[model samples]
Every structure is written in structure tokens, then in C-alpha cells.
Target: MDERVDDDITFRRLEILLAFMETGNLARAAERLGTSAVTVHRALHALETGTRCALFRNEGRNLHPTEAAQALAEVAREVLRTMAEGIRATREVAGYSADRIRIGSLYSLTSRTVPAVVTGMKIRKPELQTELVLGSNADLLQKLRDGGIDAALMAVPDAASDVESEPLFVDDIFFAAPVGSRYADLAEVDLAACANERFVSLSEGFVTYGGFLESFRVAGFSPDVVMKTDDIFSLMNLVGGGVGFTLLPGRVRGVMPQQVQLIALQPKYLMRQTIALNFLRSRERDPNLLALLAVCRMARAGLS
Candidate 1:
């Protein structure tokens, strides 16, 4: 037998084989496939010849498929399914490659939402490549304005005429403190309660830093900020090491150490952070941008 899996094994032949396997007769298979019985027979015969194996046996006037035919039918279904998926992906990308959906995000989301969005986008386009850029909300916005990134997932800032942004989810600001401290015992912490507590925070430029300052402003007393660092992990580590309590988004819980406890802010002081997907109006229809937007919505929707 001259076995081969080249172009000789055509999709048309596989379809006929599957139909015959289902109906168990040439005429019936032809009717199911909207083709003539002779055409179906010829396709099956060609398939058997290409595979160099006998896929059917004649018993009286009836043709019964052999085990090989049944096995080939299963393989054909899988191949066709994969082919359909590839065609759909190609259509989504308009057959483009070497293009990346550059995604800029905040440090907080880098631990959770960023990864989920990237994974979701890949699932939608297996060949799609993504670049995850992490920075402060201001830095991301600058990159978006300068065309450094295709899109961004970050806290929504004031609207600009050229940038298109949509709110995806609202994450509540919380008071982050050491796990066993007195602040950790409270179900929710009021800004006034932590007024005298030493505060550790990310330096200026971070969206969370603004949130932290706002919470203090609303309480009518300024926190005695003991440390101000440019990185969130360092700030979190300081908080966890009993350096001070800090204000952070709820998503930060996924990144910081177990010794750090995040408590909700009291209703009066609770700040709602609007997470949004930002893009330039000009690139709204770009296929890669579209796919990334879809994933951002899905990931945020799941969180909501």
C-alpha cells in the first residue's frame, strides 16, 4: 500500500467519506451532500486510492465501510474543524501579520487584568502577538497620544478630543495595611481613622497616588506620608513590613504579599476608580486593535 498525506487527500474526498460513513450508502450520502451518487462514489474511490487502503467492501449490492474508513472519517472531522477556525481567524485579521496590538496598562492591572486580556486576545487570534507595556496612567496616556501603543487599559482620565476611551469596570479604592494590624481588623476603614497613621505611597504620576491624596483631602486631614516611592511593589512591601498604610485599588490584592491586608474604605470615603480602554480614534477599525478591545471588554465584564 502506498500511504501518503499530501494534497492527494483532498477535502472534497474527506467530506464524501464522512457522509458515506454516516448514511452507509452511496445514494443516501449523495442526497445528504446535494451531489449525485456517482460523484460520491468517485470521491470515495479517490480517497481510498490516495490513502492506498481499502476503505469499503462490497457485500451483495451494498457497500459497507471498513474500520479504516470510519477512522479516516474521524480525522477528517477534526481537520475540517481546524480549517474552519483558521479561516475565521484569517478573516478577523484580514490576513495581516507582523502587526501587534500594543497594550499599555497600569502597574496594578499588570498582575491580573493585563494577562487575562492578552490570553483572551490570543484565543481569538492564535497568530496574534501582543506587547504589554506597563506604566503610570499618565505615561500610558502620553504613549497613546504619541502612537507608542495601540491601546491602553487604565483608569480613565479627562477626555481628550483625539483619544477615544470607554469605561469598562469600576474598581473601588481600599486601605492597604499589614495583615495583623489594628486597621486590618476593621471591615472598612475611614480616612479619618488612618489620618495619624504613617502612609506609604507611589510617587507622583501614578493614578493611585492621586486617589490616595484625594482620600486624605476628603477626610479634612493630611496623612503623615512617611515614604513615597516610584514603584507600587516597593510601596506595598513597605506597607506589609509595618512601614505604613496606603490607598490602593482592590486588584492590588492579587499582587502584594499575603501579609498585606486590603480593607474597603468607608462609604463616605470610598473612591471609585474607572478602568477604561483607550485608543486613538484613527485606529478604531484596525483589526488588531479591535480584537484587543473585545478582550478588554470581556475581561472587565467578568470582573464586573
Candidate 2:
């Protein structure tokens, strides 16, 4: 892309482009943009002229944006959001608002680990503004790489290059089944015993699911899987509803209902996951990240 062409693109033009794509009619687009229809049309014309593309076609006095228009609008949304965040961060550092930090974590940790970490950070730095983002293991790690989040609290085996990680704590995996299931009567359940049972597990992209499969692999058997969900709660609900048994981390103890029973796996298949806090190595010196690290360390040490 030519720098001159890039320089010619403006937020106003992008806004008009997005508005037009969203509303599809010049009058409606102008209403949303708080500008005259003529002005909106002029902005659209300038955008197309600068980009040297025909962004739309006339369909009975209404402009129908081409496929290119939709694609550019999508890219424009990301660019505008990134710029807005950049400006917000600069303003925050300039003392217009409290210090902001973005922390990402796995959805399963939302019930326990994240609350503990965020509470500690607020108690220590009262003015620190924190955003807690929750997603699957892969999503959180990608956010860390994209600079969307400052740190990620997730399981090990992340294996993302250029990222620095520190172990926060260890949570053992347990076999979850419906209350009063045959396995619940036993203190410990062997993987071989469940070889005939159906399992409900999370889908791929989650480290917990990986560990669950690895445990079965180590036990030399593959249990029948009835369902695979994306949410940990959904997995638990399936188990509680007697859909099938699942494997979950010990941290879910607080949220698991009495209808769900967690049986300790046999020693040979006992899987423990190390939840770690990871950030870009380049962001090692960021004070907010350091503060989050410190809070996590203190919390982990206290639990120990």
C-alpha cells in the first residue's frame, strides 16, 4: 500500500464507509453519522477515489457496496478500535484516568483464581483499572501475542514462542460423574474401569481437554465420548445431567454442584495441570504487568 494512499484515509471516511455498509441507505447512514446525506456521499466518494476502487454500485438510487466495501469496513473497525485503545492508554499514562491493565484467563478460572488475583491487585493498587478477559487457552494466548491483553493466566503446554511464563499453582484433574453414579461409590476410580463409560469433554483448543485425552492415552484405552462442548460449565452440566463423565481441574470445586461427583483418578492416570501467568518477554518491564505478577505471587504463596 502506498503511504500517500494510507495518509489519505481518514476516520471520518472510514466511519462513513462503515455506516453505509451497516445501514445500506444514504439517508439512514447520514442519520446515524449525524451528517447530511450529501456529506456522507462525498465522504464515500473520497474514500473510493483515494483507494482507487469502485466500492459500490447503484441499485435504484440506493448504493450497494461491493464485497470490497464489506472487507474494508471490517478492517476499518479493527484499525479504529486499535487506535482508540492506543489513545486511551496514552491518556491514562498522562494521568487523565487510573492505570489500566488487561488480564486474560481461561473461562474455568473465572470462579476462583481470577477473582483472587484481581482482588489482590485492587487491594494493593487501589487506583489500578483492570479488565478481566476470559476465553479458551488458545484465544487467551493469542490475545497476549496481539497485545490485546497484558498477561494470560492459563494452563501449561501453551508453547507460544517469545512469551515468558511463571507457574502460579497446580490443580489436579478429577473424573467427574453424576452424583450416585457407580464410580461415586468408590474412593478412587481407575481409567480402565471407565473404558466402557461415555465421556463428556470440552472440545479442542482447551488444555484441560488435552490433559483429559492424554490421561486416557496413558491408560491405554479410549472411552466413548457422547458430547464435546466449549464451556467448562457445560461440560459439568452434562456430567451432572448424567450425559457422561468428564475430567476437570480441582479449581472447579467451588462451582461444581452436588449433583456432580468428582472421583480421584488412579495414580497412574493422575493428571495435574500447572496454571501459569504469561506475558510477552518484551513486556517484562511493564509496571502494571509486574504488579499483576506480584499479586499472583503473593496469592499463590498464601495458598501454599
Candidate 3:
């Protein structure tokens, strides 16, 4: 390409030229592009001036494309089509799905929060497919950073430069036990009072596990762990089966089994987790993320 053409030519100019070629007049081209006729004429004039070529010839008030313009329009059409394909292919190679969004979340959120958000997202973008990936908070964050997932729904992690988050809601930590357990009858559990109680906890890396640790730390003692599971559902099952007591977030209350009960923790031992949407800061402006974020805001409005 010549330096003059390179300096003057642009995607927008090409699009306007193609529009004019198809419409046969400035007013119709502007209408097709949803722009003013003056703007369309100005863009064409600028394009002609920049290219330093005879792209158009005036016949009364109408302008006709010259031979050079005709040839350039042919190339422009192919250029735009090829560029479109290239953009799509490049995004896929980068693991950025245009029609589907892979979202990472904690297993616990699968019960309600994730379902609600996914449904809302579908309603907003009917053509979009959603894939849910369940994992611990640490795992989810790592997946997001690695581009294995588009976004994550989990407890807000500590501040990091590479990630940005939008907090949806805060969930308080509670003491969970089987229905007939002595602690089940308590109005609010005094964490220290249950220090000697056997517990089944989610293993490390889980957001709930972090809350469990923090609440216990505040209570001034460590929990007696009889088992450590990888998922919150299993830990809840263990507690429901009377295997041991465990700490859980209030969000899990909806999914607690008939055999299990959650008791509020005493104020002194209170712990809360801020659940949020986490994504790479660089992708915050992505169209897919924008749609996901809109639904998240809707979820937050109902949750908060």
C-alpha cells in the first residue's frame, strides 16, 4: 500500500464508501448507516483528500464513483469480510468465546445464585450459551487469571492488581449441625463453646474454608476436624449425617438438608464473606462481560 493511502484509509472510511456504493447517494448512505448526510459527505470528502485520488466525480448535485473508487470498493469489501473472520478466529484462539461464556463459581453457588444469574444472562442474550465451572475460590481465581474461565462468582479475594471485582452480596458465617444436635437449638452459637466439637470442613482454597478459619481465629481456638472435603455440599452432608459440626455461609441455608440446621454465630465471633464477580481487569470492557455484569447487578439488587 502507498503511504498516502495508508495514512488516509481506515475501516470506517471503507465502510462508508461501501455504504455509498450500495446506496448510490449520500442521503441514502447516511440513512443506511444511521448517520447524517453531512457527516457521510464529510467522511467521503476526507477519505478522498487523504488518499489524494479521484474517487468521485460530481454530476450536478450527485457524485459518482470513479474507476479507481470502484476497484478500491471491491478490495474494501473483501478486506472487511476477511477482517471479520480474522477477528472471530483470533478471539477463539485466545479462548474468548463470542457466543458462550464460561463462568467459574463455588459449588455452593450452584444451588441458587449461579442459577439465577445464568437465567438472567440467557434472557438478556438469547443466543449466548453459558457453561458453569465449579471450584474452590482459589481455584476459580486461578482459572480466571489463566483465561480458563471468563468470570468467577466467589467471595471477594484480597486486593490484587491483575483482577477487578464487583461485589454482589455479603454472607454471614454460621454454625451448622444435624437437627438433633445440642447446638442446633441455640439462638446464636458462641464459637468458643463449640471448640471441642468434632467438625467436618471444606479443605483449603475454598472461600468458606477461609471464613471458617477466620471465625475460629476470632473465637480464639481451632476447630477439631474429623474430616476435610473438597466441596461445600459434601461438608454439609457430613454435618447433616452427624459426622461433625462445620461453619457455613448463610447463602447455603437454602440448600441445607432436612437433617441439618444453621445457627447464627455470636456477634463477637461473627464473620461475613463478600461474594462478587471476578474477572481480568483488562477484559472488563468486553461485550460478553458487560452482559454478565448487567445480570450480576440485577442479582445484587435482589440480594442486597
Candidate 4:
């Protein structure tokens, strides 16, 4: 009977296995574990030797966990949870329980939505510490996946598998045209009416842009995009200049230039960009995450 239970391989091999299960690829798992594929391979070899069973099998380029590995995963998860709780308890006992909440947001939210939410949260829980990070939707999603942020406020993408999203708000998209434009006086207009008009748009990867494309698809026409800018304010400025009309969030009406007219669409192919509070489903039980979520929900209700 091998009683060498405290070997470093025991913990490290379990960590590698968990990483593999999360990513389903040796290279990605190794990257998450902060080691090379060779090290992960060696760790798996040690694990198989210690257990006297095959843990995984290579299927094409990906590694598939064997039935034994699948069974072990539940145990591994519990072990890791216990280890984490132990560390947390130790830290708490040492009077180091100042928890940190890390949050990420898209640029649009960072301007007003996130700040307002953070302010409201602080007023309610002054002792809670928080860190805010801002980036494009894709960048923020990647950061969340990498565990760099505990939660994020973003426009929910079409496909989000591992993330749990709670819809916070539905931001309506509108057309912003110059005040005196031919279509300015109309209460509503269809996209087909402006098919020949030049359109200013946000650069690729922006949620606004994504919504714009979807709206066009529903309207049965592709927009004639004449210029693309990353900044919503810049796009607004161009629309004010009569360079082109642009699709923007309803919230943007509050910041539009005096010369810009925001037209609500009729038969309203209303493209609602949904703002959601997203967090890794695996971390839903963390106290810090729960607290932040509570704060976010309160803030969202107040705003609504």
C-alpha cells in the first residue's frame, strides 16, 4: 500500500486534471496551469502510475477523459473546494478578510452605468473593496474566462456557454441623424428608407455594431457603411456633422450634440442591446461574487 499521500504530485496532478476538464485541450490546460504541455503530460503519467489506471485517451487532437477520469473529476472538485475553503478560513482567522471584488465592463458602461452602480454599492457597503476594469466586449470576455475578473457588465453576446448572465437592462438602439436632415422630422423610419444613405458605424467587435448588423439583417438590407470609428462619441460627432447617420443606444440621446436628432424606429425593428451581469457559473457561490451581484441588482432596479 502506497501511503505517500502528501506528495506534491497529488495536488499538482489534480490541478492539471481540473484544467484539462475546463479547457479540453492539453496546450490550453497547460497554459491555464502555468506550465508546459510536457509538464502536464508528465503529471498525467505520474497520476496514471500512482492510480494504476488509464485516466485519459487521445481522440484526434483532443484528449478525452476515460470513465475513471470522469468519476475522479467529482472527487477532484470537492478536494479543491475543501482546499480553497481551508485557505480562506486561515486567512479569515488571521484578520485578513478584506475581500476584493474585481469587475470588468465594456467601454459604454464604464462611462456611466458602471460608475453609477459602483457608487451605489459603496454607499451601501462602504467597507467592501472593488477594482474596476474596462475593455472591449471581446477583451472583457477573455479576461473573465482567464479569471482576471470576478464579474462583468457587458452586452450579452449571441453565444455564452460557461458564463451565467442575468439581464440588467435592455438598451434600445436608435438612429441619430443631423437635426435638419430629410428624415429628421419623422417620428419613425425604416432602414430600407436609408439604404442609400451613408452610415457611420462603430468598429468591429462592439456590441452596438453587432446589434446594428442584426437589425439590418432583419430589415432585409446591408447598410452602406461609409466610416467606422471605435468611439461612440466620435460617431455621434460625425452624425452631427452630417457625414452620416449612425445607430446608437437610446442612452446616447442624453449625450447627443444639439444638432443631432434621435429618431425612434417605427414598426420598431428595435435592436435592444441587452446589458447583463456575467460571471463564471463555477464561481456563483463565492461570497464576494454574491455580494457584488446583489449590489448590481439593486443598482439596476434603481436605474430602471
Candidate whose TM-score is highest: 3
lDDT of 4: 0.80
Residue 287 lDDT in candidate 4:
68
lDDT of 4 by residue, 160-233 (tens): 78898887888888878899899877888888778888998988878888888988887889988889987788
Per-model root-mean-square deviation over C-alphas: 13.3, 16.0, 4.1, 14.7
Q: lDDT per residue, candidate 1, 53-86, as tens digits?
A: 9989999988888989888999999998899888
lDDT, ranked from best to worst: 3, 2, 1, 4
> In order, what lDDT does every prediction score?
0.83, 0.85, 0.88, 0.80
Q: Is candidate 1 or candidate 4 better by lDDT?
A: 1
Lowest-scoring 10 consecutive residues by lDDT in candidate 4? 91-100
- Sort the candidates on TM-score, descending order: 3, 2, 4, 1
Q: Which stretches of candidate 1 lie over 4 Å from their true place?
A: 1-98
Q: State candidate 3's TM-score.
A: 0.76
Off by over 4 Å in 4: 1-3, 6-98
Residues 82-192, model 2: lDDT tens digits: 999998887565323337788889988888788899999999888988898888888888887777788899986545678888888888999898988888788888887
Question: Which TM-score value belongs to model 2?
Answer: 0.67
- TM-score per prediction, in order, is 0.66, 0.67, 0.76, 0.67
